[model samples]
Target: MLRLLYVMTLTVCCLPLIPGLGGVLLSAASYLPALGLNEPNLDGWHAMTSWPGSGTALQLSLFTGVTATLLAILMTFLILQRCWGTQGWNRIEKWLSPLLAMPHVAFAIGFALTFSPSGWLFRLFAALTGETEPYLWSLVQDSQGFGLILALAIKETPFLLLMSLSVLKQMQVDRLLTASRSLGYNASASWLKVVFPQWLTKMRFPIYAVLAYGMSVVDVAMILGPSSPSTFAVLVWQWFNDPDLTQVPRAAAGAIALFVACFGVLLLYRLAEYFLVKGWQSWQFSGSKTYSLPGKYLFGFVALLPVIIIPVLLVWSFALRWRFPSLWPTRTTTRFWEQEVGNLLELAANSLILGLVSASVALVFAIGCLEYRDKYHKSVPQLVIAIPMLIPQLSILFGIQIAIYMLPGQWHVPATIWAHILFAFPYVYLALDGPWHSFDQRLTQTARSLGHSAWKAWVSVKLPIVLPAILLAWAVGLSVSFAQYLPTQLLGAGRITTLTTEAVSLASGQDRRISAIYGLIQAFLPLVFFGIALAASRIADPQRRLARHADKQVSSNELISTKPNH
Candidate 1:
């Protein structure tokens, strides 16, 4: 039964990638039978290559993807070099959950609200300068992709920070720091020379994840990217969504081009990692030359951007006509809320059910995999788990959708939920990997010696101890599920109406008010789940303490009973 369960879990969780990849390749090559294109040809390839300034779009995509990912990595390390194992670390930990919980879509919307030319910043500038003219600078949709880079950098930094915390914890940073200090190295030098190499080596998966996201992110790019010749992924998406049937080949070609782009970038990352970190062994051994980074100020700026943005979103949510040059809303009303309340409720319910179900399912499977790893001393290689995360969602979802059709069932909510779980599992698994591996096995052994069954030992000894991580993983999964755009759209066939799908579709219509409302509500879903996860973690900690106290009390009572009455 155990073996069967393990096989079933692997099949369900990791086996879909083959078909997903195969389907996309076949379709992109013009072999999709469902679309009645049986003869494979280079027409798709021609379309991909011959489009006007297509090369520029692809170049822009690569530049934005790599630069944003590198910037985020730099920011993450800076924050850790300064704040790890300090008082600020605790505060960062507290905020990390909320920050991670905020979906990319939500972050992009809030970013636009603050940084767009006609946004809150411009209003402030107008008020201070007494100039009726709003700022003319095109910050939001600038042709240079600066806004996209900054937005992605800010959004992905928290993810890298979270991953770094786990890696640093497992590395035993204190011992390393002490040894480096004994060797006469300062804090910054110690980190760079003694700690960074090892940390970066272990962080390959998360870094790949960041790269994949930056390279292929569609929703965020749509909001903040250049419109004249949008990012490659967005251009491909437009091709796919084109109403013309003949354009399917063009879209498929674009998807193929995107796949190549992502693959090339991944190769570049690996080469860079090898050259900079591993190949240069001399760098680690070189004499220390202290480098000073303004990490505190960098973190302050990153934090302050979101802080300023949230109020803008809230104010916009209630504004009826808060036009240009108004420091505050010219008129405010609750009507947006009242108008959206009913539809928002329905969307919220759909989003909540999908997020809760998918995250819960993924958590169960993650626990199973972790337990199997612990007992068997064999692990699912990180690359296998990272494939879904590191591959562009648009690149593979079409293939997966075709595979779903090949299955013996009609597409419905269950299929959509399953796709969400498939995507969410890797994240949930990654989130739990740190805690699960770090758990001491001796406690389980002690429980077993005290006559607890294996299952009982897990529940009473293991589960309680790692329950905090489980909750956090659940939140991570929930956020991933909530933020899903392409998977739900492709798999759900427009029947499943999550906040993301609604938000994206509404944004296409370019109604700022409607889009803002949807964006705020989309942000709210994960916030609610993370809030519950946070409270649950705190309550679980207290309960474990109480249980420990009760165990001690019982032991004392037994000792008293054994002694004489005096």
Candidate 2:
């Protein structure tokens, strides 16, 4: 039965890649029979490549993606080097959950509100300088996409930090740092020389995830990215939404091109990582000198950006009459809330239901796969499992959307939920991987020896031991589902509206009030689930005494290793 379920899990989560890719490839090659383009040819590819500003858009995507990823990585490393074992580290950890909770769209919305020429920052500057002139430069929708790059970098840093937590814990960073420092190296130099290479290698997937997102981010790019050329992903999105039916093949080709560009960028990043760590060693061994970074200040700014953005969102949601150069709203009203509250409840209900159902289903599938791997000592490779994550959503989603169109009856909700599950499963699997690997098998073995069946033993013995991780993984899946924009939009065909789709739609309307209300709600929902997960983890443990002790011991060892050597 377990083996059967494992097969089912793969069928549901992994099999779609076949049809998704095949469908897109077929369409890109102008082989879609239904549209009367039966001959396989390069016309679609020609159309896509020949489009105006196509090269510029592709360049923007590459530039913004690479720059943002590099900046986020550097920022993450600096924060870790400065605060890993100190009391400041606690604050960093505390800030991570909320920072991570803010969806990319919400962050982009808030970022636009805060940094745009007529935005609050300009108003504050005007108030200080008493100059009525609008700012000369535009960050939001600028031609260069610098704003998009900055926003992506700032938003992704916390995620990389979160991914690093397990790596650092598992790597025994404390001992390595201590050993390096004892060899007459300073703490910073020791970390730079010894720990960074390992951290970079282990952090490859998270960084790739960040890079993929940076390259193909549609909603956020739509909100804050340059408009003249737009990014490549946004260009593909526009092409897909074009009213002309013949243009869709071009869109399909564009999606394929975007996927190729993203894959190429990932490959480039891998090569850079190889050279920095494996292919090049002079930088590591020759480095006894390390310069101090303003990590505390940098971290403070990164953490505070979201904090500031949220309140601005709240104020905008309630503001009735607010003009430029005014520090606060002249008159605030809840009309937006009043008008949206009814629709908000419906959207929230839909979002909540979708998130819960998809996340729950994905969690079960992930656990089944993990258990299958453990039992058989053979399973799908990590790369196969991560296909959904590594591939650009725009690439496969177009094909998946077409496949859903062939299904009979109403499938918007199911198709949307299924799409959510497809994306959410990998995150849930990753969250559970560490815990499942670290879990003790003896507990289950002992239960089995006591005449308990495998299922019974798993239920009574293994389940309780990993309940916290399970709950957390469920929440992670929930969050991933909640944050989805493309899948919800494309698969639902705009008929089904979730908070993310709603937020992105409203953002284009340029109504700050309505956008903030949706953005706040979008960000708030997953946080509630995360809070519940944390509370449940504590409650389920009854006595988290051992966990607390282990954490303290880890922190103490880190602190001792990081202390300055006279």
Candidate 3:
């Protein structure tokens, strides 16, 4: 039964990658039989490449993606090196949940609200200087894509920090710092020389995820990215949405190009990582001098940026009439909320149903895969499982859409939910991996020894111990599903209306009130699940005292050993 379940899990979670990739490949080669283009040819690639501004679009993607990733990585390392063991670390960690809870779309909306020429910043400048002339330069939709890059960098920093948590915990950074400091190196010097290389190496996967996201992000890029040429991902999305049927192959080819570009960027990142850490070892040993980072201020800025963003969203949602140069909404009303309340409920329901169903299904598959690994001592490789994550969604989504088109039924909900599950499973699996691996098998053995069946032992003993992690994993999956825009938009065929899709669509209208309403709801849905997960984790953990004490001890050890004289 377990083996059968494992097979089923793989079918549900992993097998889709095959059809997804194949469909995209065939369509890219202009061999889609459904569209009456049975013969394989390079016309699709030729058309995609020959499209005006295609090169510029690709350049935009590369520039914004690489710049954002490098900036986020640099910020993450600086925060870790300077503040990991300090009291400020607690504050940073506390802020991580909320910062992470804000979806990319919501953050993009808020960022535009704060940074756009007519946004609050300009209003403040106008009010202070009495310069009523409208500003010409704009960060939102800037030609160079700097706004998009900044938004992606700021949004991804917290995620990189969150990803760093487990990596840092595993690195035993305190010991490294202690050992290095004993050799007459300052705390900053020790961290730079001793801890950075290993941390960077371990951070490869997270960095890949970040880079892929930056390159392939459509919704966020749409909100904040330049539209004249747009990023390649956005261009591919536009092509996919083209009403002309013949353009389908062009879209497919663009998707393939995007996948290749992202894959190339990932390799470049890996090579850069190797060169920085391994090829440049002289920097590690040649210097006792180390530069101090303003980590506290950086962290404070990153944390408080969201705090400011959320409130602006709220204010905009309620404002009925607000002119430029007004610091606060001059006259506020709930008219937008009143008008949207009915549709909001339905949108929320669709989002809720999809999120719950997909996340639950993904969680089950993840659990089954983890159990299979434990029982059989073999499992699918991590890279295989993470293919959905590391690959650009636009690439395979075209293929998945083609597969769905061949199915003989209404597939909007199922296809969307399936896509959500495909993407969500890897995160669920990763979230549960640590807890499942660290679980004490002795408890299950003891239960079995006491006349329990294998199933009974797992249900009664192992399940309870890991239930908190499981809940958190479910929440993570739920969040991933809720935040998804591309999968839902493409697979649902515009029949399924969710907060994310609505938010992205409304953003183009440039209605702050409407955009705020959708963005707030979009951001709120994930926080609901995250809150439940946090509460459940606290409720499920019986050894709160021990856990708290262990955390304290770890913090103390890190502080004592790695505390820098700043």
**How do all models score by TM-score?**
0.94, 0.93, 0.92
Candidates in descending TM-score order: 1, 2, 3
Highest lDDT: which candidate? 2
Error of 3 at 205 (Å): 1.2
Which window of 10 residues has the lowest lDDT sum in candidate 2? 287-296
Compare the candidates by TM-score and give the number of the best one.
1
For model 3, name the residue pairs that clash.
none
| Candidate scoring better on TM-score of 1 and 3 | 1
Angstrom error at residue 292, model 2: 2.9
- Per residue, candidate 2 scores C-alpha lDDT tens digits across 275-325 of 999998998888546556568678998988889898889988999998878
Judging by lDDT, tell me the better candidate of 2 and 3: 2
Per model, how many backbone clashes are there? 0, 0, 0
Which digits, one per residue and each the tens of the lDDT, describe model 1 over residues 1-566? 44554565677666767777887777778787777888998777788789897888898899999999999999988898898888988888887887788788877887887887788887888888887876778678789899999999988898898898779988999999999889888889888888888888889989999999898989988888888899999999888788875657777778778888898889988998899887878988786557665587577777777667666777888888887888788888888788888989898899989998999988888888788888888777776688788888888777777778778868667778877887898999989999987889999999999999999999988988899889989999999999998888888888888888888777667666677788888877788889988889877874778989999999999998999876
Which sections of candidate 2 miss by over 4 Å? 289-291, 446-457, 545-566
Query: What stretches of model 1 exceed 4 Å from their correct place?
Result: 405-409, 542-566
